[model samples]
Target: MFISAKNIFKNYGSTQALSDISFEVNKNELFGFIGPDGAGKTTLFRILTTLLLADKGSATINGWDVVNDFKTIRNNVGYMPGRFSLYQDLSVEENLTFFATIFGTTIEENYDLIRDIYVQIEPFKKRLAGKLSGGMKQKLALSCALIHAPELLVLDEPTTGVDAVSRKEFWEMLRNLRDKGITIIVSTPYMDEASLCDRVALMQNGKIMQIDTPQHIVGEFPRKLYAVRSSNMYSLKDDLLHFPEQHSVHLFGQYLHFTAREREADILGLRHYLEGKNHQNIIIEAIEPGIEDCFIELMTENSASNEN
Candidate 1:
């Protein structure tokens, strides 16, 4: 394993931030932690990157103990935090050079590693880091992180707050880096991006709900799912919530993603119920569960288990 954590726990004053968290990442694999804010993704990343110590449990990266081998890990791992942390007043090239110098290397020495991403932002090399556009800043931050040629890259929500096109392009860069034998562990609140990872750990309330390949997680969703819509979306959602056979109902984009309590749902019966409620242009069809659907299902299951 390139990265591993066992029974990790963390607390912030009186509140628990992480509870019994554990997962592993194989070398050269692209692993993701998918969840909303306060899911403990950042806390866990801090521990893994040796920036913060865990209240309990232990973790190792590349055979180095995170606590004792902090200096070595710092040298071998590139960490791009959730927020842009480069020197704001420095030019893009200056920032990259500074990082390379700190790592006892020069930009020219590791230029090949960051060539693809840096080229996109090279035209703006002399631009102040703070003045660059969101996409350009993203590319520059990534270039700075990669200038050392680290074997493991840990990015905490690297694509957040960027345009859709930038988000797509950033993920493509990550994929390219992974192809070159660099292990990457990234965290993102965007569930759709989970599918882009080799495997994802779905997290909620300081715990992992599920960890598996996106395909397997969706395949294991234990209910018959249907996408339901009508002329009045709000009313349709309310009505479906009251439906007797509904296992769960949540709004998803333009439709209400619904699951039946029974393994086999009565679609015709559901349509009739909506019609009786004065719903117009009712459309109800079975649909395959996506990463969001699977995440919601796991979250719901976790809540139920806790209550029980």
Candidate 2:
């Protein structure tokens, strides 16, 4: 395993931040931690990167124990935090140079490793880090993180606030790096991005709900799903929830993604109910499940288990 976490636990005073977390990442794999805010993604990343200690359990990166070998881990891992943490007063070139120097290396030494990302911002090399646009800042941060050519790359929500195009480009850069055999562990709130990873660990409320390939996760969705919409979409959700055979109901983009309690649900009965409720232009059709659908189902199951 390139990375392994076992029974990890973390707490901020009385609030549990991570609970019994455990997962693994293989070498050259692009593993993603998928979850929303306050899901303990940052806390777990901090622990794995040796910035913080877990209240319980253990983790290792590239065979180095995160705690006892903290210094070595720090040297062999490139960590880009969730928030931009580069020097605001320093120019892009200066920031990259500083990081390389701290690692007893030079930008020229690992130029090939980061050239693809750095070239995007090379034109703005003299611009102060803070003045760069969000997308540019992201690229600069990634370049600095790669300046040392570390074996493991840890990114925490690298695309949270960037434009759509930049996000796409950033993932492309990551794939290129992975193709060169760098193991990457990234966290993101965007479910759509989960599909881009080799495998993903779906996290929520300080726990991992499931870990599997995006396709497998969606394929394992227990209930048949349907995309439902009506002239009054808002009211349709409430009505669907009130229906006798609802397994789950979540609003996804422009439609309400619904699953019935039984696989062979009565579509006609559902349509009749909606019609009786005076809903017009009702559209209900079976649709393939996506990452978001799997995530929602896992989150719902996790929540219900905790409540019980």
List TM-scores for all candidates, in order: 0.99, 0.98
- State, as a TM-score between 0 and 1, how close model 2 is to the true structure: 0.98
Q: List lDDT for all candidates, in order.
A: 0.93, 0.94
Evaluated at residue 89, the lDDT of candidate 1 is 100
The residue ranges of model 2 lying beyond 4 angstroms of the native Cα positions read: none
Instruction: List ranges where model 1 is wrong by over 4 Å.
Output: none
Candidate 2 lDDT over 1-308, as tens digits, reads 99999999999999999999999999999999999999999999999999999999999888899999999998899999999999999999999999999999999999999999998899999999999999999999999899899999999999999999999999999999999999999999999999999999999989999999988998998888999999999899999999999888899889999899898568999999999999999999999999999988888887788799
